[model samples]
Target: MADGETPIFPALGAMAPDFDMPASRGRQVSLASMRGRPFILYFYPKANTPGCTTEACGFQEALAALGGTGIPVIGVSRDPMKAIESFADKQGLDFPLASDVTGAVTESYGVWGEKRLYGRTYMGIERATFLIDAEGRLVRAWRNVKVPGHVAEVMQAARAAA
Candidate 1:
């Protein structure tokens, strides 16, 4: 990836990028730990912001259904562990919310890149979601995700994949 060039989402069927980061509940999440279990890994720009909050809550609401399929959802951001923990508590989210303070995980996932908002350009995490199968292969990806009805779509895809 060149400077100022947009990062491309990892090719489908490719192994998802590896990650190991501190998360809410004083837990550490990594791709290796999640092997043999399909899971959802989503990246949002900031913690506790409106869109992020909505997305987190939506996943929380669908936890039971998701868990029924033995799939866990993990949210990732560049926010520090403290902020990520606070957001998880405030949102009543039981799933892991990992902090990628060094930006490596986000960059590896192709979610960290140039972002434009309110006519201002900046570098940040793009709102994105990826569903990885039990084998750690990327099964589905949603970039530039819109919050409304997104979880339902994920749920449907998860059912099919599981």
Candidate 2:
């Protein structure tokens, strides 16, 4: 680890950083292109991992409610498109899954930071989600998230915000 690199967190109510990254659907998705529609932006550690798959499936199961609240879900991970595509197909996840190969987007969102495993420290994406309003403001956020019932909370937040 660097001697003086401090961690950062995303500020509440701030506009999320605009990003253009590859999606599992064989195209690039930019936040700006999704203007006028609210979205649920979530970042997971990796694709096909147990927790990440559960989170993705949870969102998949709640798509109707999410969409009903006029919010669409987007999952992000530092995986290649091939891996993401397989994960989506295996989990039946309809939400768009973006690949942040360069990790720039994740770092910008403050999700990529120091992580620990068995007393070893490293850098990785922290499970997180942000509910963005149509005007591009952060309406709600969950950082270092727990997988269980997280999507449901997001759905509720979306409805309440709407």
Candidate 3:
């Protein structure tokens, strides 16, 4: 979990890390509350950034379809609650965008790790996604995510799981 080291993610079919964090709309989202329901939990580096916005908006566009499958998407970031709320409002994102200010949830999920940009090494949240079933088992995971067509791929997997 040190900076510049690759993260060790949870194994497939294992229980995902638990989380309880503040989110947009003045709500608190938690794994316990989401029990008995499948959900998509994604981790992004920052709110309102290009890639993050694209990913969030893509999920927004597919919200209805994802809703049909009875799976809700929750976005997580290490940004503060105020920033997350602003990003959600500016993007018109209907899904919950949880703020993990303490970095505990992101660390447990193995998304907060080393990152490099423009030859500068730093620590940040990796763009990742997890599909958890009703039983809290990890059904699928995507790490080092690329933006284009990613949401469609996730949607397809969600439908299949559904």
lDDT of each: 0.94, 0.86, 0.94
lDDT of 2 by residue, 1-56 (tens): 47886437556788878889888767678889778988889999989999998889
Q: What does candidate 1's lDDT look like per residue over 50-96, in tens digits?
A: 99999999999999999899999999999999899889999889999
Give TM-scores for every candidate, taking all chains together and pairing residue i with residue i.
Answer: 0.95, 0.92, 0.95
Cα error, residue 61 of model 3, in Å, equals 0.5
* Candidate 3 worst ten-residue window by lDDT: 1-10
Clashing pairs in 2: none
155: Cα error in model 2, Å: 0.9
- CA shift at 43, candidate 2, in angstroms? 0.2
Tens-digit per-residue lDDT, 1-162, candidate 3:
688874488888999899999899998999999999999999999998999999999999999999999999999999999899899999999999999999999999888888999999999999999999998999999999999999999999999998
- Candidate 1, which segments miss by more than 4 Å at Cα? 1-7
Where model 2 places Cα greater than 4 Å from the true spot, the runs are 1-7
Q: Which is superior by lDDT, 2 or 3?
A: 3
